[model samples]
Target: MPLKQFISGVAEFSANEVLQLDSEYQTYLQPLSGKSLALTLLPIEQTIQLQFTDSRIDILLPNNRADDVGSEIGSEVDSDCHLTIQLSALSQLRDTNQLTTLIKQDKLDIKGDLSVAQHLSALVNGLDLDLTEILTNKIGDVPAHSIMGTASAVVNYVKYVKQHFDITLGEALIEEKQLVASPLALANFSDEVTDTRYWCDRLAARLAILEKKQLAGDK
Candidate 1:
């Protein structure tokens, strides 16, 4: 059927996309040049071994490619340095420096080898993707610059609005607290009201007695 053919073509296209990994990683080959390290993600228990050589880097996928470990299998590739980290830790890292800081603070755990951690940090830190250059290539320099400037302005405006909003909310909270009576204050107010009512009732009774006495004297 035509629908089946379309699905098959999509699968074939994805297969070709996976083959393009070499070209994509070639740009990063310079910094990751001499470092060979293995990173193991716990819980799911997957190992990603990156071996850098004279020519290109080889990535050993744990379950799928055990044979690639070859002569280095249990020696350099497997036993060199297994950096164990949680998947959650990876998500929390905003940049390369955050990982190193967390590690130094003892918030992030690095076991097996210290060299692995150092190599990983250096490799990540050395990576620099210049979005300005990429944007310039896609669009003209002037237009790209204009777009970036507008984006920066919008971000600054949003931050300004958020800051004002937080200040206004804090002021409103203080005003609300001042307007509302505390339990102790309310109790004191209630006692005063009861005392006023009692005094008023006593005054009324004394006035009635005085009026009766005046009537009797008139008779």
Candidate 2:
């Protein structure tokens, strides 16, 4: 299937899953009733709008032209708030209550109603779905436990490898290749420049004073 279709399917499935808990956790979403929010994923330029009711949410892909995946956020959005985020940061959003932290880390950007965004974050963090229990019911308990264990291990391993790779690449650029300056080196160089400028200004002032004294003597 096409990328857009796949994204739409995922969004729909996610919305349905969220709504399944609405009956029990509708209080979290009550503040967002009759409101809408737009989330735009960067680099892919896909925008998904979430229309919230008291107990349901409808996810939609607005201005989904595949050819314009590089275009800006669609102007057709009528959401109470809009959130723009990097695609890579979606995983970090699992900690939905840390909206301020994510913004500080340059992982998310928000516009429009901040209260709506906060309420949305509260709703996401409030979800208490027992995925392990669901899996145990669908399959056997042993299989469910094994699958969850394997999934968790794989995720941890991937995170470790990614961290290692980033550190290695940064070291190569800063130390091995000398393409990027080390922080200490940069700071020292900045201090040297500042000192040179200060001395130059002082020397200029002294020369002016000397010239004035020489003129006074000649008079």
- How much lDDT does each candidate structure score? 0.62, 0.83
lDDT of 2: 0.83
Question: Tens digits of per-residue lDDT for model 2 on 49-136?
Answer: 8888887777788874547656556666778898889899888765766767889998799889988877888887777777777788
TM-score of each: 0.42, 0.58
* Candidate 2: stretches off by over 4 Å: 1-9, 18-23, 38-48, 61-118, 211-219
Off by over 4 Å in 1: 1-80, 85-109, 177-219
Error of 2 at 189 (Å): 1.9
**Lowest lDDT 10-residue stretch of candidate 2:** 64-73
Candidate of highest TM-score: 2
Tell me the deviation in Å of residue 193 in model 1: 34
The per-prediction CA RMSD against the true structure, in angstroms, equals: 17.9, 6.3
List, residue by residue over 64-176, the lDDT tens digit for candidate 1: 34455453322333535566566667665446567677677654555565665565455445545455655677797998899888988999999999999987776665556
TM-score of 1: 0.42
Instruction: Report the Cα lDDT for candidate 1.
Output: 0.62
